[model samples]
Target: MSTNTTDIFTIRAAPGTDIWRKPPTTNICNAPTAIPPSTRSTGPLTSFLSACASFSFPWRERYDQAGILLAFRRRSESSDSGIPPKWIKTGIEFYQSQPQLSTVATDTWSDWSVTPLLSSLPGAETEQWTTILVEKSEDEHGKSIWVYRVVVDEQTGEEKSRTALREICWVYGLDGEWDLEVVAMAARPEKEVKDGEEKELVVKVRGWEVKWEE
Candidate 1:
């Protein structure tokens, strides 16, 4: 495959809450079909890019469809009326299915795109523990865009994967993945992340972003 520098860019950050605002270090996982890189206009491209940022549309529509949701219900039974009990954790079959969440109001989860039309969005400074968002839009020129945010964590060591230093190390583990590919968008000031107990903060993590047109 040929490489195109025009659409690729990257953002860098130090640590702690300032990574947002930073542009993402984007590398096209795969180019779209029918459209060549040389033909699209920049204005449309910028608008499209911003729209992509607005909505978390999937980069790959095929084999990218999946969602994990968790729900909680009170154990208390009804007095007179009978309401059927809902699963303590009724949601996606993968991650949410593994852990039973009866006591918790929110179900913890990990998943990728539900459709090839969807792509995986990553969180700010991630190693695992990424945040995810969906790309919801009607069509181009119609106002609406696509974007995504996903995170990951080291389930075994349970290490905090949000640290830049640790993230750098994590990238190496991915074999020069630049590792930031999944979560480049959220590193922006427009986004923030929740770590253990610390509050989320706006960040300046930009340099590259992903955008596509049809």
Candidate 2:
């Protein structure tokens, strides 16, 4: 069976770029809220089964991130509604002077989770690469989308381990009115460049794969 994969590429995120929605009752003042620009490849949401990617970037500032984003938009909805599409982004995020594996899901508001990388040490340089997978999964309760942190063997180029990071239960329905946009996204919400400074956060996506329903 053949597989669909993307070539190695980079995504440059400027200052003030982010993809997030704050919850009600949470103060939006002093927070950066904007849809971060992304490089996208889209397909029918019903045809999407799974996606995985391996990526890395230098960790320098708070909220520096790069990873896979799954965005869903209803076909019949108009842009005039002023509603943002539901989305999930999973990847490496810099926080507390270290790099963490992070995931965010947004339906009405955004919820975030982060954990230290299993192979990393405090104050050590960031890992050479980090891999993640997002896929539709089911258990006895019902259907849902699952996110996983994947560990790969460097010598053999095979999967070494997989750890579940999050389970998103509300993304399973919509009939056929929704389409999916899979994106390679990066963001730096707090790092502003000075005048004449050309520095930017560039994330290197080494590998990307998406599987569709057959």
Candidate 3:
């Protein structure tokens, strides 16, 4: 099989920019507005197979994050209850003064998980680039989406190892009436710049790949 990779690009996320949903009417969807059209992929939910990307950014301040986002929205206008779309975002986030692999899945509400970056892993010291893959998978029980932290070779950009981070089963149930959009995303939830500050979080994306159904 052949593989495709995009050239390096940057995404600037303003302060207080985030993508989150919560109970009792808390929905924030202000992060992807900065993304360029060339970096986004959209299709029917059933047609989406997988999405992968490599991201790097300077870790500064609280609630800073950069990663791959998979968003799903209902296709029919009547089925839409005027609610926010379901989404999954996985990547490296700045927490506890360090970078950690984090994943957040949103259905009716948002749930988050985080894992430490082990020192033994490749490129863990510099905390430069982190690769994440979100793909469709199935087991005897049912269909699901798997989130993986992929370690790639610095020289050849080939996969060296991958660790499973999360498995979301609820997402596939919406395939019958939903469309999917995948893109690189960045957010800074706690740092809003004041007047004339000119400060923003810039995330460097090394590459992005999306697989679709044949």
TM-score of each: 0.20, 0.82, 0.87
Candidate 3 per-residue lDDT over residues 98-136, each given as its tens digit: 688999999988999998866423432244778899998
For candidate 3, the 10 contiguous residues with the lowest summed lDDT are: 118-127
Compared with the true structure, model 1 gives a TM-score of: 0.20
Tens-place lDDT digits, model 1, residues 38-114: 32222211122221111121111111111111111232332222211221111111122121111111112211222
Ten consecutive residues with minimal summed lDDT in candidate 1?
Answer: 163-172
lDDT of each: 0.21, 0.74, 0.79
- Kindly report which residue stretches of model 2 are placed more than 4 angstroms away from their true locations once superposed: 1-3, 24-39, 78-83, 121-127, 174-176, 191-198
Q: Which candidate is the best by lDDT?
A: 3
The residue-by-residue lDDT of candidate 2 on 75-130, one tens digit each, is: 76523324346888888898888888999998878899999875765463455688
Candidate ordering by lDDT (highest first) = 3, 2, 1
**Measured by TM-score, how close is model 3 to the native structure?**
0.87
The better candidate by lDDT, 1 or 3, is: 3
Off by over 4 Å in 1: 1-12, 15-126, 129-136, 139-142, 146-209
Query: Against the hidden true structure, what lDDT does model 1 obtain?
Result: 0.21
lDDT of 3 at 194: 50
Find the candidate with the highest TM-score and give its number. Answer: 3
In model 1, the number of clashes is: 68
